[model samples]
Target: MTSALPTRRFGGFLFDMDGTILSSIASAERAWTDWATRQGLDVDAFLPTIHGVQSVETIRRLNLPGIDPVAEAHALTEAEMLDVDDVVPIGGAAEFLAALPADRWAIVTSAPRRLAEVRLKAAGLPLPGVFVTAEDAERSKPAPDGFLLGAKRLGIAPEDCLAFEDAPAGIAAAEAAGMTVVVITETHGHAMDTAHATVTDYRDLAVEWDGASLKLDHRI
Candidate 1:
């Protein structure tokens, strides 16, 4: 009676926060859209492409012609600060994280430390054992720096980890780090075809860790 996929065991789990553990895309979109409107930019055209990228990277990729990227980044940060309450935990996210052994998982996000804390706290999710934020890496997602840092911190090999991501950038990051990736389809659209597996949400999956070996129960 559950929607689960084939399961695999791994040395550790790397998790993405925003759209993966928490349902904050609405808040993010609202913040970005409002900032775009205030700056006389096109929200409809830019918002979709910017999701899942770090704020600074999002600014660069939008290619806003002559706009000040620093100012735009600050504006987006301010907007997100103003709309932090819009964040919520994805269905069954708390239970899913809690079910796993603490040492077996970590959070690797493109969000800066403060923002990542705000969203995770607001969503009432347990903080991971290892948290690698944007400040921890020179390059963000699609670069593997974050995931590599996370695996290093966890004292685990990149190839022995499984990553849960909601964006192609995060998926690419994990893959680049030699980790398996499970994509969540709720936040990011189903446009990516790169994940090891795709799932509707954490609610449809089950996890078990027996000290030495991590086991994922596909029966949910």
Candidate 2:
């Protein structure tokens, strides 16, 4: 009852951090819940729209009285770094990444560089050779800027890249970047039909590198 992963060779890979390669929803939600309460915002109402986008976007949407989004983003990042609870790599995330050459993949995340480092280290994942964070772009996911920036930095054509994502915003962003996307449905619950394909986790996929290109194929 699941969709298949694309079985094509790509010039490079673009990965979204949270909910895709790393499972940090528990820690992220806790941080947001606590932060939301401090700002007198409802946690349940505020957390849903924030995933796959920068915390600054969430803060702006909350529009707290006279609160600066930049400062709030730092505060949230601090809390997340402090929490560290229940953060782990998604299934097969480590293996799939390890199979690729260092230069063949990059991380494009909605998290700030600081928070992204903390989470990646905490989750026992290696940092990408090329990393693009929220700090790299003024516009977040749903805009192509971050993914485009990542591909550019990787020296790979955006259209030749393949993206892996777990949220609708990330899917839109990858598509906007002129890349194809595979939805990792661990968080989005298989609802991301606009993706090229869907899988429950990296466990459902496999990667092969021939030094010149990478091929991602479905395992089952």
Candidate 3:
């Protein structure tokens, strides 16, 4: 007989907000476009690179000489929260999350905490028990700081956490933090070789509380 449940258990889950759990690309693009236009920068050039990184880092990367980076980031955050009409959860996201123990999962996002919360609420997703945002880390995605900090805050060891990501930078961050990654394809196309697994939607995944711990199972 085959086992009905997955055997491997994880201490906790680390999820990326924008593309992994809730789909917020429209709101993000709207805010970034307005910011880029106001700053007289190349919107086409900058938009592609900002998806998985922190807004402050993106501002720095743009190297705008006159704008105050901190104030600019704040402006962007306010803009993001103002227009969340299109924000919604990815397929099966809510159901999968509802199945897990609240303490066993958290969100690690490149968005500032306020923006993250706004988007989550707009998308009708529950606020996570532990939330890690751009303001919580000295560095963002592609750096291990955010993910490591999130795992630490969850009271879980780095290696025991499973991270779900939708972009290359997030995948790198999770791996650098010593956690295995499950690459969700809501944003990225082909799965990176570094990811432990890949899924097009949360439909392929299921989480369960196995009495003592939470575990994840996938179809492929």
Candidate 4:
């Protein structure tokens, strides 16, 4: 017999977009791989580092001579915007999001606003009312700036929010902002190494709000 699942409540919810709510891996990897090839870098080595970080930060890390990271990142976003044909929402993502009260949730992503918007549209997800994107933060994930901004926009304290993420950078960022994290393991091929709670998808999760705080529970 299976054991009963855990339940928790939070004043607000923060979500990381690409991997947690939707799988943009195909479109993202395709665009990044082309960029890496153009830059004469090892595609396999460079691709992994691109996930969960801003394109500007990813480009800056290469330290390639004469390359303007910001300009290149913008160009990359332009390219990504046109390639959302393969983008799709993660299983049960839309339903889970529908259950949450709009004012109590926000999307915090490392992606720039335009890119994030285009991708979400392609995946058929709603545009969140409070979205904290790369331009809204001075620093990217693992720094907590975006997550903190998201909480602030929701009018909730950072520690009172529960964050959902699917990458190490995003998880660390939420934690740094003093929020508990739940890792989404749907797109991962290997086991995630985190002490935070993990779920493969939102299919087994449910949310409820009764004129007060939001409560989330495993539906098993």
Candidate 5:
């Protein structure tokens, strides 16, 4: 049997763009792999664990003894930007976001503004009223800063917001921010136990935002 759909009252919703709203895993993986090959790094071994992290951070995590994190990140970003065509919206994401009240939702992503805009526009997803990009926050996901900043922009408390994330780092970020989290399992194969709930995609869930409260019909 499937897990029950969880519901809660949230003042606003914060979303992670890449894998959560737009399905950019393929493009991201290809870019990273190509960059890794160029760097003489083990593409097959490190690519999966680096997904959802900022390119610079990913390089640092590799701890490649002599690698310059900043330069590598720039290289990867340039490659990924060129690979945007492979990105697209996750199934049902567009309709689901459309059904939500515009002011109550925002995009909180680790992507830099330019790349985020390129991917979102490519996917044809409506831009959220509020957007918190990597440049807007001092720290990225797993740090709660992005989500908290998004909530602050929306004039909502972190605890009063809900976040949709596809990576364990993002789930941890939202949970640390005291917000409810819904994990979408499209990019990562691993399961996250920390999320309030999980869904294969938006098609398996339903949502409605009344002016006073957001009603999530998660039976599916």
Candidate 6:
């Protein structure tokens, strides 16, 4: 027998762009791998670390000599913007998002605004009215800044929002912002090790506007 579906409700929703709503792993990995290789960094090790964080943060962490983190990050974004041939939405993501009230949802991503727009368009996803990009926050995921800003933009309290995320840093950021999180594991090769709710994708879920908030049900 199949397990019972889980249901939850919240005042609004905050979404992480890359791994949660869509999968840009191919384009992202290609860009990062090339950049890392050029920097004499271990591509295998570096690629894994690039997800869930801003490109500038990743480059800044390397402490590469004579490198401008901002400029290098911009270069990386330009490369990714051009390599969207494989960009696609997570399972049922486009439809799920279509059902949501535009004003009740916001996208909070570690990607810069232009890069975020490029990937979302490539994946054929709707552009949200409130998009909180990396440049919108002083710090990236694990800092709660971006998620917090998203909630603020939606006119909802941080604790009243439900966040969908796919990476460890993003999950942490949502929690820090005092919101419940639904982990999207569609792109992950392995099951996520998370205590919060988890789903393979939006296919198994249903969402409705309850006049006051969104009622989400995930029946696996």
What TM-score, computed on C-alpha atoms, does each candidate reach?
0.90, 0.93, 0.90, 0.96, 0.91, 0.95
Best by TM-score: 4
Q: What is the lDDT of residue 217 in candidate 6?
A: 81
lDDT of 1 at 60: 79
- List per-prediction Cα lDDT, in the order shown: 0.80, 0.86, 0.83, 0.90, 0.81, 0.90
Shift in Å, residue 220, candidate 4? 5.6
Better of 2 and 3 by TM-score: 2
What candidate 2 gets wrong by more than 4 Å, as runs, is 1-3
lDDT of 6 by residue, 42-146 (tens): 888778888899999999998999999999999999999999999999999998998899899999999999999999999999999999998899889989999
**Candidate number of the best lDDT:** 4
What is candidate 3's lDDT per residue for 1-220, written digit by digit as tens? 1123325788888999988998888888998998888888788887888889988888887777887888888888888889999999998999888888888889999988888888889978999888998888988889999999989989999999889888889889998999877777765544456425667778877676776667787646
How many clashing pairs per prediction, in order?
Answer: 0, 0, 0, 0, 0, 0
Candidate 3 Cα misplacement greater than 4 A, ranges: 1-7, 189-195
lDDT string for model 1 (122-169, tens) is: 889977879998889889888999999998998889988888888878
Model 6 scores a C-alpha lDDT of: 0.90
* Pairs in steric clash, model 6: none
lDDT of 6 at 48: 85
Distance from true location, Cα of 167 in model 5, Å: 0.7
TM-score of 5: 0.91
- What are the clashing pairs of model 3? none
* Order by lDDT, highest first: 4, 6, 2, 3, 5, 1
